[model samples]
Target: MLDTLSLYVAAPEILLLVMSCAIALIDLGVQTRLRNLTYGLTVATLVGVTWLCVEFALEGQTIYAFGGMVVSDPLGNWLKAFAAVAVLVTLVYGRPYAADRDMLRGGELFTLSLFSLLGMFVMISGSNFLVIYLGLELLTLSSYALVALRRDNANATEAAMKYFVLGAMASGFLLYGLSMLYGATGSLDLDQVFQAIASGRIRHEVLVFGLVFIVAGLAFKLGAVPFHMWVPDVYQGAPTAVTLLIGSAPELAAFAIAIRLLVEGMMPLAIDWQQMLIVLAVGSLLVGNLAAIAQTNLKRMLAYSTIAQMGFVILGLATGFVNGSTANAQYAYSASMFYVVTYVLTTLATFGVILLLAREGFESEEISDLSGLNQRSPLYAGIMAVCMFSLAGVPPLVGFYAKLTVLQALVASGQAFHIGLAVVAVMLSLIGAFYYLRVVKVMYFDAPLTATTVSAPADVRAVLTLNGALVLILGILPGGLMALCADAVLRTLAG
Candidate 1:
């Protein structure tokens, strides 16, 4: 049995599990018309979890609980806090859209989302490979159900099937890779695996071979090129509300996965994996940008854009520990951390605007559907423009700073390959800018296809406004967040 201190360290996860189950039961007893009660409880639960994460982060100690199965540390706590907030915002943006489509007749959305969030918390904190794999399954399963929540929609069901099949394959790849690592290193605990690899008793060829599968699994999760077949389909087929849920918060959890597995467990093999990441990054930037240029569907375009953004994250990861020296590891990892966090922030606002523009019986998913948004609602149009500009790496926005930090990290390594890769990333980003700028052009320059009033609830409006403002504010004064990321990565590495 776990003791009080161990339980206390894991209080957030414990509380979330309890709250999720309780909400499910309570929802069953509530009348269909009273769904808002369940929604309120879900939001409150997430708020409480966020507060718990904040408290833990403030303590700033690296403590292992459940005998090192889970860790209570700055990195996990920060990511957890952000995930909670992201889920809360996602629910806020999703509710109206769901209700409009009769998808909120039950509490399934709220419950499944909470469960998925719990999985993310576990993924962020897990110190064991099995624990991480378990969490990934929970998240992926919940997401599949959520995508297919509207069972009557053929496209949603089809997308869900694709997600399920691809997800299962990816999970299998990850598990097989872990088994290979266990065989090679004789341990499942990340720290032990790290020590074993450092000891170099294992066969080098076997380790590198396992790394191929591991990187392939991670690429699928991150939706990198050649492994990203499911992303655009799922994003386009699922309801916009579900797409928002899948896209924003999960990126934070995915970042945690990379940190735990690659940074903590396999830093010794950075050279091998770095080569794999470079190929993935370059392919992602090239495919994601060029493919997005031809997309007519807004959600599909953003999905491809997601692939591109993740390329930057991988670029940041590839720069850490250059030439077997970790002198620049802290800076490189911190830059990756910062990029993922800021990218999630920008994504939420972009999707929030999309959700706000949607109405009953209308999905508002087409790029041309956004014609003359400025004429209809300047507030939303401005918010969306900000998101687009930031995503395009335009100056005076958080995305620009995010890109700059990563590019700087790459260039600062003083390696010719790193510098050349940075240049390639810059050029790809410019190419990607064409699509983002096209959205802005449609919003401001084109004529409105529908003059429907873009009316969102006050709460949604308030949250969207804050989300947009944060992007710009962080751009101007990113030092604080940057420092937080650096500290988190540093403490994680030190521990």
Candidate 2:
């Protein structure tokens, strides 16, 4: 029993939840091998949710709902919209792959994806600590189930077990940190916690102890160093389509929660958390890039690549607060937002190609599998090349601009230390470029493993082509998205 305003604020989430359940039930009766009806329903609901989010974002109003535990703001709305679109695109790419592997036998892929997306939406909108944690659990638990969807695959089962155990530990860390914060501030609401911290009546030592665990949990979610043991394993072991689902859209939710917990709730202790993030960023950049170069498995390489990309995002987060002044916070955070959005876009297309190449009995898990991909299908090869180049930060690709903004944020901080970090980032990026280029070199230079031509469903072909083109097009004209990010950040901060 909610009021009109509260319902309005939560409309998209409500719609998504009810429709996802309906579709799951509908799937129970769908007998087709393709489960076309279930997919259609899922896509329709996602489209409706995306449209609702876009409309809410365009209105640019911040509304606190459910007793102020949830918020609908331009930032949350935009993230939710992008996440929905990402999920929709993921389903499109994942369908044929899942079908080939018999992973779609029960339409579990569609229903589970929708439920996971519901988790992301909740994470993006949550304004209270407990609410945010609840969203996180929903997302992670759904993710674990998704990883284990192929119960017969030993690799997938192992990966799901690892994901569940580590994910549970991370959840415990976050929960304990929140409890400590609650003990210190005597509040579970984010606004109240912020006020209590700003008042500086609590013990700094207690807050710092809690902050340590909090930062660790956040780093684990971000796949940063020292807590990133699960990333490569899960990424390499899961079905490629499921890999795409886990890799792409969930990042937006993770970024949203980072902002909600760190920037919004705990800004009073900026110096402490920024230091922790700086350490994590540097380690992730160095370790992720160097580790990627040593990998022969394409999925594993991309997993490490994801770690490096997140390092850049973390760098942006670390610099948003400089020398006790919040003047540059919006610019720095917006740059992180832009980086994450573009990274997800590129990741979706990159994995799309991988999923397309996979056959019923043969998984394209090795780097050698992509040899001579350029000769087999120039269009898809070109698309993959664009993804690789974009990830390498080559000019006129979205990843280049994404890295530029993050580096610009770091350099703009005017601190010698941050500038030094920027220099290190550039050097580490050069190392990253080598690994990415290696993929392109194998695609173009090496001989074909087989003479069979690569083919995809018309829908996948069209959508993948569009997805690839957007990487280049958005790179060429990134102002629109960049502006959206900046405006959203400004609005969030202002509110």
Candidate 3:
């Protein structure tokens, strides 16, 4: 039997699980008014879990529980906080949209979201491949359902099917990689795998194959170049709320998974995977940014943009020195973490604006639809302009700092080849900027097609305001967040 103290140490997950069950019961009993109750419960549950995460962070003790399947550390603490904030923002931005569409009543959406958050916690805290895979599947399954939540829409169903099929294939790749690694090292725990590699007992062939499969799986989750085909369709088809959840939160969770698997589980094989990531990163950067130029649908463009942003994170990770090299690794890893935070904030702000602009009969998926937004509502147009500018990596915005950090890391590593890639990144960034700014141009310059009088709920407006303000605040006062990201990277690599 687990000790009481052990359970307390895992308090955040426990609290979430219990609350999920209570919410499920309430959902079943209050069928008529289930939407309000479920929304309240979802918010309350997230608040409680977030509080627990804060408590754990303050305690600042690394604790392993569930027979070492779960481990809580500073990195996980920070990531949990990020996940909580992402979920809270999505719920706020989505509530009115869902209610307006008459799609908010069922508890499945909130429950699934809660489960996904739980999976994120597990993924960040897992110390072994088995645990990581389990957490990943949990997150994946919930996302599939969330994508299909708009059951009446054929597009949503098709997207969910595609996501499910591809996700399963990706899982297979990951599981095969795990099996190979286990066979080679005779261990599932990351610490044991590292020890095996350090002892020189691991063979070159097994290590290479395992590394390839593992990185492939990670790339699939990140929607990186060769594995990114599903992203646009999924983003276009899923409900905007679902898109926000998957686009913002899952990317962060996937980044955490990559850090855990590569930095911790495969540190000894860094040289091999670093080369692999470099290729993947450059490929994704080329494809994602370039392809986005052709997309007129706003969500599809953001999906491609997400792919490009993931490439930046991968570049940061790839530049980090292998083995015991601390100086370069510290810079690279810290840059990657900072980029993740920057990307998350920008993405939330961008999607929140979309949610705010959508109305009863029309979803704001098209770039053309934003025409004359400035004339219709200058406040919203200003908020979206900030988001667009931030995403385009314009100066004095958080996105610019993110790009600067990654470039600095590349330069510090003396990888002059990255200079060429950096130039491509810059060029593609300008291409991306064209679309982003086009939205702004349409908002301010074009004529409104119809006087639809789109309006968002007060709650959504409030969230949008906060998200937009955060982007500028972080842009201007980035030192503190950058410091925290640096600390998180150092602590993770230390372990």
Candidate 4:
């Protein structure tokens, strides 16, 4: 019942699964303070996975495997490659910090992170409701353990407990919604469900009722408003390295899941869900930007920034399916992809600096901690400045083009309300700019809290420098990535 090419289609996932388990076993015997053996193997595995994903993505074919419960598509493959690269960068930035805090005493961080990456792979490619739910649970459960990785820390324990309870409730909402759809359409497979919905045979009320909960669940995963309560607490309380790990890469997977569920599976119902996305986008922009201004803790401030950034991504999603038309779907969704990808890039650079500044028994959670960073280490300060500027959507940085494309998509719709939302989004971004620039001002203008220069391992230095440069370089030449996203989305719809 399975195609012979299915294994070829799933080679990356299969390779990752085998390597992750092998690394876990190998780490048991790794006693070095840095766990060099385990770390090298893990990095190599991720590199292989990334390479495989990119290769497959370039092939530009959509293959269904496991009886259509999984898909290998250009969009999914590229997103997976990005996720792998993000995790690789996170580990590079986080390992030295983890060692400082005694978090590297065990191999758990590496193993759990690898497992979580595997979960993301499943979520991105999952073509059935139950399979996607299982993938979500795998990712969240690993994340809960990861947030609680500092077992001795009270804040971490509390954060983990809150994440667990709230995450469980959100999972229930998504499952219940999926169940409603299954009952209405008599199928759990996404393609069949799409066919069912597009046939217009299901009752509108039932589909709408299910959609409400589904959207709620998706919003929580993306840290959108009303469901974003846990984001700040978890980001602040988790070990800084863990915070970077959580904040950076899983987002691509989150974006992928949104595309799979809403755009691919539920396009026929876009009229219903797009309205919900609009509301969520407005609330996220309003609350996230305003609340971030009041925060002095660097992690919590970035947490709110994350919420606001997601608002732009949501708007891009909302604009795609205007008036039940898929005419502009690829353009709108591609803009959202560019936004999430670039946002993740900037996030890595920002948090990498934060992780580097954190010293033994000294957390760099406070904004004042970065005071006069330029006086201490101009290289890192410049990197951090580039990140802040990009996040603030300054011109010639990736984030500006990201926002512009989404706004362009909105205006292309030619709807008064859509244009009005575009205006509101621009205003909210202006407010968001205040906090992002505030970090920049403090880094450049304030006096250094410590005269000691900041330092990083050579690998971290190289990766972080490349990352910061990309934010600027990509902004200047956004066409390649924009074209890739456009092509991928088009292939997905065609597939």
Q: lDDT (0-100) at residue 13 of candidate 2?
A: 83
Better of 1 and 3 by lDDT: 1
For model 3, residues 279-305, the per-residue Cα lDDT tens digits are 899888888888888989999999998
* Per-model TM-score versus the true fold: 0.99, 0.99, 0.97, 0.99
Cα misplacement distance, residue 324 of candidate 1 (Å): 1.8
Q: Please, what is the whole-model Cα lDDT of each candidate in the order they appear?
A: 0.93, 0.94, 0.84, 0.92
Clashes of each: 0, 0, 0, 0
Candidate 1 versus the native: TM-score?
0.99
For candidate 2, list the clashing residue pairs, or say none: none
Better model by lDDT, 2 or 3?
2
What lDDT tens digits, residue by residue, belong to model 4 across residues 269-380?
Answer: 9988999999999999999999999999999999999999999999999988766678888889999999999999999999999988996359999999999999999999
Question: What C-alpha RMSD separates each model from the true structure?
Answer: 0.9, 0.8, 1.6, 0.9
- In angstroms, the error of model 4 at 45 is 0.4
Q: Please provide the root mean square deviation of candidate 3 (C-alpha atoms, Å).
A: 1.6
